[model samples]
Target chain A: MTKPVVLTGDRTTGPLHIGHYAGSLRNRLRFQDSHEQFLLLADMQALTDNAHDPDKVRHSLIEVTLDYLAVGIDPAKTTICLQSHLPALAELSMLYLNFVTVARLERNPTIKDEIRSRGFGRDIPAGFLCYPAAQAADITAFKATVVPVGEDQAPLIEQTNEIVRRINATAGRTLLPEAQAVIPPVGRLPGVDGKAKMSKSTGNAIALSASPDEIAAAVKAMFTDPQHLRVEDPGQVEGNVVFTYLDAFDEDRATLEHLKAQYRRGGLGDSKIKRRLEDILQALIAPIRERRAQLAKEPAYVLDVIRNGTAKARSRTEATKRDVVEGLGLFVL
Target chain B: MTKPVVLTGDRTTGPLHIGHYAGSLRNRLRFQDSHEQFLLLADMQALTDNAHDPDKVRHSLIEVTLDYLAVGIDPAKTTICLQSHLPALAELSMLYLNFVTVARLERNPTIKDEIRSRGFGRDIPAGFLCYPAAQAADITAFKATVVPVGEDQAPLIEQTNEIVRRINATAGRTLLPEAQAVIPPVGRLPGVDGKAKMSKSTGNAIALSASPDEIAAAVKAMFTDPQHLRVEDPGQVEGNVVFTYLDAFDEDRATLEHLKAQYRRGGLGDSKIKRRLEDILQALIAPIRERRAQLAKEPAYVLDVIRNGTAKARSRTEATKRDVVEGLGLFVL
Candidate 1:
């Protein structure tokens, strides 16, 4: 049986961090072995929110691509493409936009939350509000049967399916498919400040490509449970950043459990635990950092990979768009 | 001084009608002599409102092209192309969309009036709302300097220039030029049913390629002032469609004024005016219809003209898009 094709992407807003690894990128790495994958660097979608800062987004595109390569994501197994290079995606988005009511876009849970969080309110950019339909185009252009997302992003898939249904119904053509959702294991990575979600804008993130000294400094400054004032006093594990990092990245589950019990028993000091967690993190990230350095040296080679992948992606999309255009009689011939 | 370029287009919603002839197509004929012209068949813009009925839009693309040819929009002087054929337009639109806020789009007078008129209210499609910005992309993709429009559409130019200002302001680069509005002398033509607008869905349009019999039938069914019941009854000429058509199409302005005076003086019959208007229409339309028939034989040639024009247009747009991409530092090298 042909493994279902999966489509996923990220807006080129910033470099990947540990949160991305615990959240979705790790799953993307695993899926490459069994499923067809199309990963996009969504610079166009990024502009919807970052409109004033193209320079920011432009640089981040390379940063995100480097992060992806730094992880275990193989370009040979996965198609990594630039979103702006495909015109059909935007064309498809314009068509799908007609099928979605402004009221419906306003009602999108993810978008609404983003609007509130970004403080855009009614002052949102029109492009930002319409991005879900753009995502529909991205998924449909790839003929992707599956999309891996977090529970929060499942609504985006629902929105894409809504557009798919409406397009088929209105055009009376079944050129697009409804994509299935694959919910990644939502691992909550505490920020350096002990916030629930690690993010770049908040300056709470530990970047995937941070050097050992930077990582060491960040780990040293990380917040721990405030109630545990002294090492002799009993510590709480519920809000501990060191324990959370260990839970997220440690491969030795038994060892982590043993360390947690010792810490709660009021005998383990914070520095010893911090050192152990840092070792585990460096062990995992050292090889990725080495690979990233090697890849960065050959920027031309990395770019060629992205461009070739984009061409491959565009080839698949053109076939689907040809059928779509033919179905609508836009084909002049 | 160099001659400035002019960009104009029609959304492929239906066949071009006499209203289109008086409104914009006639101006395009005049433009071909002095300005470099780019006439786009906006399939992508049509999708904003006609998202569900793509087949309707698809079928209209050919019909609209035929009308352009029939109306003597010269192939040698104008470049006619499809909106979807150029990826650069979509890419440009995506970049521009970021600079426009939802409040700004909502504040557009034309969109506000259309929302009230179409009864879309809050249920308006997001695409429908962003149309002005998309139109800005069409104008700027070719760096068009003169945009011919009715007074009602003048605000679109205002919105486009606003984008140009904001982009230059933020990007710190004066790459795009602000377009000037060229309001056509003759505004909207009323339908046969006496509605202020001639529209296809309203079933009151006389197509540009309407046959002699069809025009006669449509003219006979036209609404005039109700008080003009008898041949000797003094009539109001203000709302008379017969007089309206004469005002728009007739080159003999002194002759038309005399006919209007006779009707207002209670001596001329409606039939006399109708017959005279029919004669005037036939004279203008007869050669146009003949040219249309001759062009229809080589449908392949018509499509080919657009194909070659599309290639030329692509080269022009690709050059601009490269500048934009490079300005944003998206260049891989």
Candidate 2:
């Protein structure tokens, strides 16, 4: 069977961080060779929450594109498009608003939880409330068969499929396809403070394009086993984030196994273990840093690629819009 | 000074009735000559309430256009357009949605009254709630300076101006113009049963394009003063619907006053007055009926006129969209 079309991206509120890389960006690069991929700089979606800060979104679009190129997300294999450039997505969203009830939107699990978490229970922006419908438009607009998202975002895909089913039924045309979710495997990387998740806003994330010094500083400060107070005390590896990073990125299996056994058997200090882990991290991240630095030299070319990619995305979307207009019976002439 | 622009429209929910004719179609015909007028067929607005049956709105677009032409709303002077043909309006509506709060939309006097009147209190279509914002887009899309509406529609204009002010202030550009309301002298022609309003849904409307037999039957059954139980008894003339129709359509002031006095002082039976009123209504509606019948024979040509008119309206709207996009700094390329 042909590889399924996959769509995923970040809202361009800021640069991609280590949390983003581990959660999605790295997976997107891997998916490119096997699936038809679309990496969107979702400026419009960013506006849902960042309405007062257009400058942030505007600047982030460039930063996000550069980060993607630096991280080996090939533009040739994965179309990187700007979300607002596709006007059809907004139009489709407006049409879908008719099929969806206001109550139904308020009941959307992910969006509702986000609102509650954001403490905007009574004062949610209507646009924020309606962004899920906008996401539905994005999925159906691309006609993607597979959507890669974390478990928390599975509800977004479910909402998109509901819209697809309703729109197809109403138009009496099967123009939009439902998308399947591809859940992330590693779940989430813990922050240096041993927090459950890493985030840019939480001051717990290292950026994808961070320099060697920044990464070293971040990793050096990471929390280890709390009870390993003495050099001779046995260390814990089960909940140790250093072991998690080693499990995810360390390539020297025999060396890492010896270090783990030495730590578990006692007598290994935290500094020695830190140095070993640091070497492993720097080796794994050196190439990503080099590639990103090279891409950053030509900001103009990166933007040009995004522009060209969006133009191609728009041409495909325009054809879909014609079908949508016909299906809605809004043919003017 | 160049002629100011006028924007007026009918919601394509049903056939045009005499209430529509006397209220708006009459003003549109006169205003077309004085201003650069755009008559919008607000099918999208109709869909807010009539969403379950979109075909009704789709089919009525042509009929509404025919009614405009039949009543002397000349396309040579006026541009008639379908609301959905211009996607820019929807885009404009989204931007305006941000400047407006949900509380403001809920507090809009016109929308609140309409919600209660339509029995859509809490179960309101969010689209229905936001359509005032949509109307703001429609009005400002053309940068229309004069909007002909009834007294009840005044708040919709206020809502539009609120957005216009916010847009201009936010963009630091005075691109959108404030539209003023143009209320007619007569609020409504009243139902034939002497009811306060003639609504299509109320089954009390006499269609402007009603056939000769339909018109004759409608006039014969029209409500007069109920106090005049006997033809010889004295009757009230002030609230009598026959006199109201005469006041609305009769150009001959002398004949109207004479008939009103004769019907008031007794001796003139209801049959005599009904007969005279029928002749007067026929005399008034004959040319419109003939035009409608003749246009009905060539539905294709009428459709072409609507197509051409919508194209012109769309072009005018696009010019405004370009200005707005530039004003908002949203023109990326």
Candidate 3:
């Protein structure tokens, strides 16, 4: 049986963080061997929000690639492409836009949440609002059968599927396949400050490329139990960020269980628990940081991988786009 | 002094009608020698509304080109290009979309009118809604200083200028020049059935390529003064489509004035007037029909014109896109 095609990507607005590693990148490392994966540096989508700061998007492309390389995402197994490099994506997005309604885009829950978070209430850019369609193009342009994403991104999958179904129904041909959203086991990692989500703009993210000093500083400033002022007082593990981090990263289940029980029963000091969590995080991130530092010195090798992968990606996207254009009776030339 | 660049085109939904000739194409012919002109066959724009009927758009490409050639639009002087052939337009449109807002797009009177006319209430396609941006890209991609358009399209030019200003201000660079709208001397021509506007879908338009028989048939069925049942009755010339056609097409102003005076005084018969108008129309349309027939025989020649012109267009659009990318500090490679 053929391996199902998987499509996934980063916005390239910043380097990959622990939240990304825990939520998606870790799963991608394993999937690289079993599935046909296409990882994209979504610079075009980044420009939708950062149109005035394209330099940030440009710099982050290499930074994100270094993080991916450090995390053991084998370039030989997965195609790593840049979004702006593929003209087919832009063409497909314009074609797909004809099927999506303005009202439907307005009702996208993910977009609504993003708008609320970004505080762009009334003056939301048209590109930002229509990015769901652009994403539909990105997902379907490869005819991707599966999309690995966080739970919060489920709406994006739905929008892509809707465009797929709409095009198939309208064209009376299955030109695009409906892609399934695969949520990783450790769905999302909370911010160091215990926010519900970890993001670059939140000032709570610890990048995979963070130095040992930076990681130590971030771990020390992590939010913890408020009422546990003394070592003898019982600390809540349910909302404790250190425990959450331990749950996501710590592989030694027996020790974690013992620590959790002691914390609930009392007498487990916040500093002690934090130290253990810090040790686990350091061991996890130290190798990645080292690999990133080494890879950062070889920019040509990194760009060469991206260029080769983007060309391969362009071939696949072009084939899918050609099928869609032919199915629609449009002159392909 | 350098010639100001002028951009204009037609949506390839159907062959050009007499209304197009009288309003825009006629003016384009005159400006072709003096101005740096770019004529686009807007097949992509046609698809926004006719997504399900791309075959219609596809076939009309040749038909529209024939009309341009038949109407004396010099392809060598006036670069005739296809919209979809150049990827720069799509890329620029995506960037410009970041400057336009959904709310602002909703407020566009032309889009509002189109939605109402197309009966796309609430379910309007996102592409149709965002076409103003695409149009802006078409105009500013060449940095065209002037755009010849109908009076109804004045708002589209305003929207384009707004985006131009917004991008320049945001990027802190004057990347695109604002385009001015130039309305032709003879505005919209009335339909054969006396409608306010001539349109292909209305089934009341006589195409520029219509044969003598078709023109004669259309002239016979034209909406005239309903109250003038007898030849002796004074006929109203204000709303008569025959007289309107005569007013637009007939260069013999002395004869037309004499006929108008005779008709007002209740001496000219409707059949005689129709005959005179038909004669004038046949005389004007015969040479155009011959030219179209000769051009239609050479599809290779027509397509070559489009291909060469598209290459020329691509060069200019690429240069402008490069500057915009550089201004934003985006990676050109």
Most accurate candidate by TM-score:
3
Off by over 4 Å in 1: A171-173
Better of 1 and 2 by TM-score: 1
- Whichever of 2 and 3 has more lDDT, that candidate is 3
lDDT order of candidates, top first: 3, 1, 2
lDDT of candidate 2?
0.80
Instruction: Tell me the tens digit of each residue's lDDT in model 1 across B1-333.
Output: 767999998999998888989889989998999999999999888877776677788788888888899889887999999888887887777777788888999999999998999899899988899888888888988989999987988898999999889877776788789999999999999998989889988989888777999889988998877899999999889989888888998888898899889899998888988888788777777877888788889889889888988898999998887876776666443
lDDT of 2 at A298: 87
Better of 1 and 3 by DockQ: 3
**Please, what are the lDDT tens digits per residue for candidate 1 over residues A51-94?**
78878888898889998988978899999998988878887777
First chain of candidate 1, TM-score: 0.95
- Per-residue lDDT tens digits for candidate 2, residues A45-137, read 887777666677778888888888888888889999988778777777766666666677777888888898878765676677777778888
Error of 1 at B170 (Å): 2.7
The digit string of per-residue lDDT tens for model 2 on B262-318 reads 777887788887787788777767898899889989989887787887788778877
Q: Candidate 3, residues B269-288: lDDT per residue as tens digits?
A: 89998999899888888889
Off by over 4 Å in 3: none
Query: Which wins on DockQ, candidate 2 or candidate 3?
Result: 3
Quote model 2's TM-score for chain B.
0.95
